[model samples]
Target: MPNQSQIFNRVVSDQEVWDFNVFADGIYLITIQAKAKNWRQNFKRLFSDDDLAVQVDDYLFTELSGKKREFKGPGTWNGNELKNSSKSVIILLPLKAGAHKLRFWVDEAPMLENISVEEMNPDIKEKLVLSLSHDASAIDFIYKNIEIENLEVKYNDNTHSQKSIETKTDTDTIMITIKRPQDKKVESVIVQFKSTIEMNYKIGRIKLYQDIILSSSVNLRSQPDDESKILESLADGEQINILEEVVIGKFIAGKSYVWHKVGAHGKIGYVLSSFVEIQGQEREKIIELIKFWAQKLNIESSYVLALAGCESRYKVYATGGPASDDRLGRGIFQLTNQLKIDLNDDSKPFYSPISDLFNANQNVAAGVSYFKWLNTTKYKKSTESFKKSVVAYNAGTGNVPVVGKLNLKNYEQQTQNLVSCVLENSQKKKWGNIWWPILLFVIGFFLAAHGFVTKLNYASAQNDITIDAISNFEPDRSIRISSATSSVDGMVYFLANTSFDCGAQNCHSVLFQLDTKSGQIRKIMDDVFGAAVDLFPSPDGRYLALVALVHGGVCNSGVYYDIIDIQSLTNLAISGYHSGRYTAEYVGDNKWQNNNAFSFSLTQVNCTGTQRGTRKGEYVYNMDEAKLLMRMEQFGPENNG
Candidate 1:
């Protein structure tokens, strides 16, 4: 037996050892042994998928995965035995006569075992076996099938007539077939009964409330109760679906009214019928509240609808849909509730107490304000980063790795892209053929499926646009064309539009006018381009003496410097910004002593800063190199020769 006590000692050394039961034969029932919990915590890690840790493989032990089960709440297991006579353990199974290995998990820890099984009764047909396994993927697959619960195991002793065998169980156990229950045809009830005894009414969550019952001899007190008490008395409006009635009487002169809970998790408990009034399911009212918050938050109504649909399913005080505390992810977005205190309290607590999550304005305001704050402070102005914050909000921040002491440039750029990618990925849902836009997300044309469809040359307006390398024939003269070339010299003279953040609700565009003599940037169009184009075009455009130009770095071309008639600002033959430091000499018809020196932008930054892993190298025009290039161009090959 390998001293079963040794196994207990190993586990108990880490956690308290609780109950253990000897079933029909060598089959045993062992509970957790986490001692600090007064040695009573047989089960640990409340939010976990037990099936992932345990695999009862294909051995010929017994077959019992398709049976019904339930959680008989609040049972306890002492170090070596089941206690409290409560139904914490549910599965009752009969093991076939054989030698087998059984396994399960304790807080995700693997507990593997080899065991010999024996039946209690000779005719074991009356009793069945119980076992479980899970879908292979992550939690996304958990909600897809049947929900199994409290299972019990027992044996019938006809085993002496049957032959015992030893078999290896690497493959044969079939996948457990889960039977999903059909949606219940809910029948709504409308029961109106005034309280014979005073009742408290709560405005928000009812699960957190504690209640006290009055015996048949207490007197009724008719004073206004505290606000907290009233709120606690409220129940889940869905209780109206069952139409359960206790048929208990009101109150007598000598007796007091009973205070009973109108809502329960799954247990069929008694409630004082006269204490609560059923107004039917509040689905419509709940929806209206959700919409109100959506508007206040400035999000689309459908976004709010989708949010509520994903969360409590529009059921205020709704629980049991899924355990919220799993992996520290909770609330509407499913992001980790990083803030430790009761976020509901806006008063005595540091952030102040919110009276109710059901309050449309407050709830919506909170959701939007949280996201908006994240967008502004952590993400700068990138829409993509905003989306990541949204995902982290729903999935828990544990996924966001905190890389310590990274180069600031890489930190900012990579983190921004990370968040943006997350936000973009989460909005996808499978559909046929080409994916389409979701009404709730408003992500614009086909996206989410193919990833974020960042603006592909929508070319709105220009903001802080700089035209690089405008040249003049002579250093003295800032006008007139000198021999010049650009990094992107082949493009059209039209300025490429670009964007700038105006530090307000929206972005603004600007046209770039660079001083040919210096690298300074100036906005050229105050009213001209604004009125000419639709508001503004978000592309870069620069003006050289006679040159008007636009540049595209991605096209792998050179800068376009359009030369124009100074007065007319009309077109003329353009020169390019030759790199490394090239002097503007009028190879064409130009006089010396004319302003011919041209300057080229060393680099362009839409949002400035280097990106480590993204080929974002810095560009600097070396003064010494520029001077040397000028001397080489002016003196000819004899300098090197």
Candidate 2:
């Protein structure tokens, strides 16, 4: 038997042989020793004559990874204890990539032990799996600001399969199963996690023969309406959940198109699904791209996704192919020539002017790259709010007005232009927090409910100060108002219930930011919460504009911090809240005064029991000073009496 000290850490001394074997596509790693060998008691830190240069199998490579990222260390990199250890380095090599015989390339003689081998393999193959995945780790997506503990996945026993999964807390789990046709063999199983819908799409199953209906418009010149002809009629406000697009046919010059079928619109036809992603795909792609680049750029993927959502609806193209004659953008992000371009191609106009943005992969890189610069450069000193910079992005650099289709007066446009100019006065004036002030996070992105949902269903830490921080206001329970704007940042803000035209309910709200440069409202968010409607931005954008149920009559509750510009829909800011409850919004912006403030006044009714009015329900008074938070009472005083 070899020396146990070597088993623990130190290598066998003098005349000893060590044996090892490696597996295919796996790596063998060894940790570095600290002071076990007792090398001559260090009289003067010098290399010992007996110390041999550390050598691993010729194929193996050394690496370091972690919170602090390291290069070389004890026998191998690990989450073990060491003073001020922020990172760990390891000697590693793939088992099948040649050279299994690794002889620790040690510079000094030392004992090695606890030969633990951990393979941090890349799941690049996972992306190729064409199956719906239930594994949270399989694809990154889910609820907002949540730390998922475990995700539970269920498998059908009838199918021959293997599965491994765990349940997570405070996290939403996506379950999936693949329905396959008997004729085709699965090339590979790629579980696509549509974080937007909280559904796992199994792409492994072969495509089945299915037929869909066309709008049957008699006037339209039959199938495949002039590709790129910009037929507003074909848009049809179709609720189709486009599966995917391919270049099926072509016509007209510079007008070739990729055809796409819809699940929501319930038909098949061609529209510009080019940058128009499948309903759930957008969010999933965002996660994958963000995670990939986050690893590369050392930033949070969520923040990147959030910024992309805010800037360009995550669309890369500046002009709209379908609706952009009006100038709306496309893709996971919405970028504009209005913004500066550090990375540009300028060769292919069809391709992104920002060269890196031309490719989907590169698009995320460019988005994050631009944001990284902004975060460090522009907003370097302003630690207060995200208003101005976002405004600047929306408004542009003194020369142009950036986003939004709503009619703008010359004054507002000039103000926006001015704001951009002022923001650009310096090089890094626009860089700051990449993502902040969430407006709302929908259940999933444009997610189509998979398992038959007629009805929809539906946070830690303290450290407080001012009394103004807390809401004396109460939310109304089960009341709803459509198109009523809230005074978040004091502009047009509303939470209205919308239909998918496919009978799906989607809640939507408008989020705004104040252009620090112009001091005008810069609504910088996409609205549409989910199922439950009546959610909107606050007059000031500090708190999400919404109404919640309280003691009785039902009132409006402004969910604070629910304002994120990335979400397709707004989520109540509270991490944990009942989903089925209905809420209402005040009629207009009368209840709000400015950003970070609400014009709410609270009054508690004195109730000693049997008094008719008081008995019926708890009433909030001073309608003039206090906006209705929620209806604490549903019925009349007689009911309570």
Candidate 3:
């Protein structure tokens, strides 16, 4: 057996063996803290050739009573740092009263800082203590081994006595409440209890009730325990109402950590008190404003919420971010002065006051509007693309490599991780909070009592639409339909993936037309240029406009467009990139002036190979003459004012 000092507070190398003696049979928490053995000093290593940075693994192998077990440690590259990071792993295992051996080794060894084991359920008695707020009207003291008859209450002042106490007991524990006087100020109270075998005293503190603000963005869990389901993530400086005062939770370094039950985002959840600071009012209004703008922009409220959580933590006066020109990041979404000017151009549909960067509503609107612009023009309309756009929002569109798979830098990856973390809490549980499950179960019970009538209605609402005699329509394979639209005359136009046979490179999905009346589906065209993003059908049922991504190289011109004459099955494919490196008509907002003509806005972008000097203006497409005409020229960059 190894010395007790060697079992903890010392480095344990790979393949090294250490033995410890457990005096009691109980669940024990085994903790291991380590850092990367060899950290990379070069920043260029962040963008490695393999697209993934090197990572180290941490796994511990243990043998107790001839039974072996493997425990996975929390060891991975920190998204925010280019260098190696420190990580801790805690595992609770049931250990018998005997000697146990643990062998630590992995492919890439990390520098072990410390390793220790503590019994979670010890045989010793617990001294109960309650951390309450001064505003608390009453608090309960429940003891398992103590009898109510043998309990006494002592207060620092004349706040309460035996006559003012309430007692109740079941088979296990006796609960007693010491009600505070309405006018008197109480500093602290002590509850003395005598069990069948021993006597102990519980010290309770009554401090002033203060507002709390999150110091950093963290998950709001459904329960006080770490293993509980996350309700949602709250941002830094966000406000919450403490439903219950703090209680002693996790213990570390001879000090107890407190977990507070708080109410936020219309739900009650538990948050560690250490993650929150004392000062900030409940800001439900700001949340409602974010939801409103998100709905107006046809974006996910959760995504926008995550963005704000990452940017400014919903703080109206929050500042400090990457500087652009002379301006730094400001307000909810951290929009710089220059970015505000660019996003608030008159050509854009949405508008906010250029000077009101500090206003909460205006700030959120501008940020969300900018995101919408990026979604439509710069990035693909998928969640992955949205993630890219988020990184673009922070770093810049030019920094993000829009090719095969995303291989972002450490900082960019961290931004994506933060947004993903916040989004997980919002999306994982649709109904939100702990009560939703109980509410759903109750509703399910009632529906079951009422028979399958309600179930049949639900099934009917969820029924799939089937078409008869559809050409080249394979029902077997899993094909994702990217976009769908319908004309006024009930004609359905859709874009879906073909059967792995696109003639053009980078084209995956194809255009399809469904005749609802005749029950027929027609394959309109093949090769829709990568994933079909959006479909817009003309009101008179004559034409369908399409948008799709081009996924070859970085300079392969990101997104392309097409216009198809539904009656003639003729397509006008608009190549996103011209051979001369000049961009071809990047058209958007194609509104039909009549059945024969439509109007669209031309967004000019930079060219590379040849300098044709791209044009920006509102243009008209006349179907009768099959000619494109410029209606009005837009102001150049020189006249941005």
Task: Looking at model 2, report the run of 10 residues with the lowest lDDT sum.
Answer: 204-213
Which stretch of 10 consecutive residues in model 1 shows the poorest summed lDDT? Answer: 136-145
lDDT of 1 by residue, 199-315 (tens): 111111111110111111111122111111222223432222122322223321111122233333433233332223222113344444445444444444444444444333333
lDDT of each: 0.26, 0.31, 0.48
Which sections of candidate 1 miss by over 4 Å?
1-281, 319-352, 355-365, 375-377, 396-641
lDDT per residue as tens, model 2, 82-134: 22121112232223332233344232333343333334233322222223312
lDDT of 1 at 359: 32
User: lDDT score of model 1?
Assistant: 0.26
Query: How do the predictions measure up, each by TM-score?
Result: 0.21, 0.30, 0.28
Which residues of candidate 2, in runs, are more than 4 Å off?
A: 1-268, 271-282, 291-303, 311-330, 337-341, 345-358, 383-385, 398-641
How many backbone clashes are present in model 2? 125
TM-score, ranked from best to worst? 2, 3, 1
Model 1 deviation from native, Cα RMSD in Å: 27.9
